[model samples]
Target: MGDEVPGVGAHARYVPGRFADQVALVTGGGSGIGAAVARQLAAEGCARVNVADQDMDNAESVAVAMGGTARHVDVADADAVDALVSGVTRDCGRLDVVVHAAGVDDPEAKAQLLSAREAGEPVDVLARLGDERWRRVMSVNLDGTFHVLRAAVRAMRPRGRGAVVTVGSSAAFDTLVGYPHYAASKAGVHALSQAVAKEAIAFGVRVNTVAPGPVDTAMAARTPAAVRAAMEAAGAIGYASAEDLADSICYLASPGAANVVGAVLLSNGGRFTV
Candidate 1:
């Protein structure tokens, strides 16, 4: 509705009963794509949705609106992540679906890089990258994935069935942003997803990764307007929406994706089509 865009139209509102009787958990469900996915699950008749996020206020808001539950969790902490899954499994009586959408973006560091560039200072992104930033990013993006997937795998093992969908970035493959740490962490997520999928399949559990591009999110705001516009135009759909991404995720977690495993669904709006 914004500009008579060819592929743009009213958002798909509901997938009624798509997840009836299911219990789902979404990390980073406070806002953005995570919140969208959680809401979609609830709309689709999920028996329960655990809205896990580091932001207590936002998480609580989303949970209350959806009539789910909120848990303040830092995905970077393995112990916390494990405990979360275990508790959810205990409360829900079964963990049927999990979407690892939780991630981080250091706006402060981005501001520094831009400020240094404006000041005519040499901006060696890698050389200037701090060890702390790299570690923190990896911990949240890669290690956090490990913690959740591993614990979920174990829980699903006893049930003999479950589905896990992870959120990866298109940066894992080709991104012009030039943020090595973030890119690498996402790449790790890609590989980890594939490996975990292969391992979980033996126990009737499925895992997949959704790598989206040019998403209109708060994190993407840090990029220059020109850069963002160019990226959007390059995509086949001309833009990315959180709801669209959630659809792919829901599909993967649903029985429709039963045959799909160890695959990375590159939802780039056909920007890098195979």
Candidate 2:
């Protein structure tokens, strides 16, 4: 852990060179991994952080806690995302980093699928895996990422210097059944980062991703004990903390990663080597 520094205003505090003087925008910054990222960046001396999420209360809470700005914008909405990017730049002057961490995991569907597995039934037999579920998952995880990345790159490219870090999942590489939508969306995220890196490099902007495995967040905590055990067995170190993943996000966003591009840094405790 690092010591906390003073904020730019009476409500904010600064961390140090980890992100000193830089402006960062984080989606899904209200809770889970997103909240951790926001706290870490704010601690690292980021001049301003815009914590955007569809949940205004959660976003505002995180913003107030970090002493940063909070905005309500659904990443799935292109216009909302565009306005958000513009608003941040106008208010904060410039944007240096963008971290996409918003995601959804349907527990009911997961539980139903897991039950089928327990009953020795074919996983695909479960009706929980429906078109609506798939669409909802993709809309948030895949399409939402595209919305944010497109908007951020537009702003970042002109500046000739910026960093974009998308949060992916170990499931993208490993065998995590029952949620094909989540897996597919994460796969798209990694692929998108690779593509972005190739194009952004010419403009001095770097793009990378961090895929975490079995992190000890609320989402993972909601998993059944058996499911959690299975996931832990796949990891070399059992489980990871939100801070562990947050550190990787910050690293990819910092100057130290100038030479690192299109890299998918895995902080999965050796669960999946990619």
Candidate 3:
């Protein structure tokens, strides 16, 4: 893992031109692991990188920094996702890799959990999980991955070679008692990735999922202190940086993972054996 991939990105094993002449698209590239992945792809000499995100400002900033293009896309909108993949393919002439990382946590649910913890109140997490909150999480986290993966697979299948890495969550398997919706959505993403990989592999398109634990991202920053502490205590290496998760993601998207398909690569730094 420490080996250098020079052209791929910083802090990675150096393999000059590992991604040269390739075209890649990273959803949620506005920040966190997605942003790191975009930068890595650019460093690896990808001919074109499309940064798709709901946050226009963040997306633009990352794209400009990496010398890539920014696209304002909400993966929940299947039509919009389709157009994004089509537009990228049309412009780049081919799509070599895709990293679907756009996802959301229910703010209401998180807020309730935090408030309850601070107040020492007994809060029923499930009862507070309203229909709207649950739906929103599912739409953005699960359906969004579906839209991106569907479009990406279609765009790459004809070419007979491509790699797709879906960013999932360790919560999916470990179970986040306070955020069932978030966990369920990510679980769906993992299952979907495997299902798609089963068919996409025949076309030479590999699909995989990366389930990351407590990384230093905005989402994790807002976690309850108690929960964060517990998670860190469980992990052998404590919290991982966004770049650390990006390394795992980029490796899966690289040729180094050509034989890896439908595998959920857990990157929790030895947190929770199960």
lDDT of each: 0.84, 0.84, 0.87
In candidate 3, which residue ranges exceed 4 Å CA deviation? 1-14, 119-123
In candidate 3, clashing pairs total 10
Residue pairs with backbone overlap in model 2: 5-14, 6-13, 6-14, 7-12, 7-13, 15-43, 15-45
Task: Give per-residue CA lDDT, model 1, range 86-149, as digits (tens).
Answer: 9999998999999999997666555555665568775457767789988999999999999889
Which model, 1 or 2, shows the larger TM-score? 2
Q: Which rank order by TM-score, best down to worst?
A: 3, 2, 1
Task: Estimate, for each residue in 36-75, the C-alpha lDDT of model 3 and write its tens digit.
Answer: 8887778766889899999999999999876899998999
TM-scores for all predictions? 0.90, 0.92, 0.93
Once superposed on the true structure, which residue ranges of model 1 sit more than 4 Å away at CA? 1-13, 112-123
lDDT (Cα, tens digit) per residue for candidate 2, span 215-253: 998888889887788889987799898778887888888
User: Per-residue error at 81 for model 2, in Å?
Assistant: 0.8
Worst 10-residue lDDT window for candidate 1 reads 1-10
Clashing residue pairs in candidate 1 (N, C-alpha, C atoms within 3 angstroms): none
Of the candidates shown, which would achieve the greatest TM-score relative to the real structure? 3
Q: Candidate 3: lDDT of 182?
A: 92
